[model samples]
Target: MDGQPGHEPDCKSFSYTSLQGGNIPESEIIVAKRKMDPKTFSQEYEASFESYQGVIFYCFNRTLSASNETVQPNDVLHIGMDFNVTKMAAVVYVRRGDQMHAVDEFVTYLIRQQ
Candidate 1:
């Protein structure tokens, strides 16, 4: 999919194949197994998000988007809210280290428009 604006390209799903054909090496299989582990995957995601410095916000529709990675933490996350809309947003902050700071924050918006 080209990076052109308004281009809704087709999405592809993951296709898994059996390794009985001896095409996949043993080391590759081990790494794949570890990555497939739920605990390991979650921890890796958390680590990646934590290490990255930026403002992450999830929209009211449970959509997660991170932007302004260059912005500092002291800066209040700027959000545009529609006055005519009946909805609210929740922010999730995750910190790293013994004294974790606001490295990444997720904002989830909830809409209850009739």
Candidate 2:
């Protein structure tokens, strides 16, 4: 477990006995050690988002999967949008089978509210 603050509870929940001397195989124990300084490492790993730092998801990518493909006429298009007083943004995608393929994105800045 990490030695960072607030990680004490998580460290205590695991069975140290099993981790240290129990029936667990040495080969299966995945120990990830950091080579860099803690503060620098934390900043890069956290990517500025404290709450979602360590969580990994498949949909996070720079390039859309369906960027080169054409959306079929019958395909269902899904859009997710975020609206604020000064800014509005949206993501467009289509689902095929179990995977969601992003097609485009839109963003607009509002200078005046009506």
Residue pairs whose backbone atoms clash in candidate 1: 58-107, 59-109, 60-109
lDDT of 2: 0.56
Error of 2 at 85 (Å): 4.0
**What are the clashing pairs of model 2?**
none
Cα lDDT tens digits, model 1, 38-102, are 43443343232232123222112222333234435565444343222334333433333333222
Residue 66, model 2: Cα distance from true site in angstroms: 6.8
Per-residue lDDT tens digits for candidate 2, residues 1-114, read 555557765554422434445565545433311344344344444233234333222235465444554478988889887674467777788887788877778888677658
- Candidate that would win on TM-score: 2
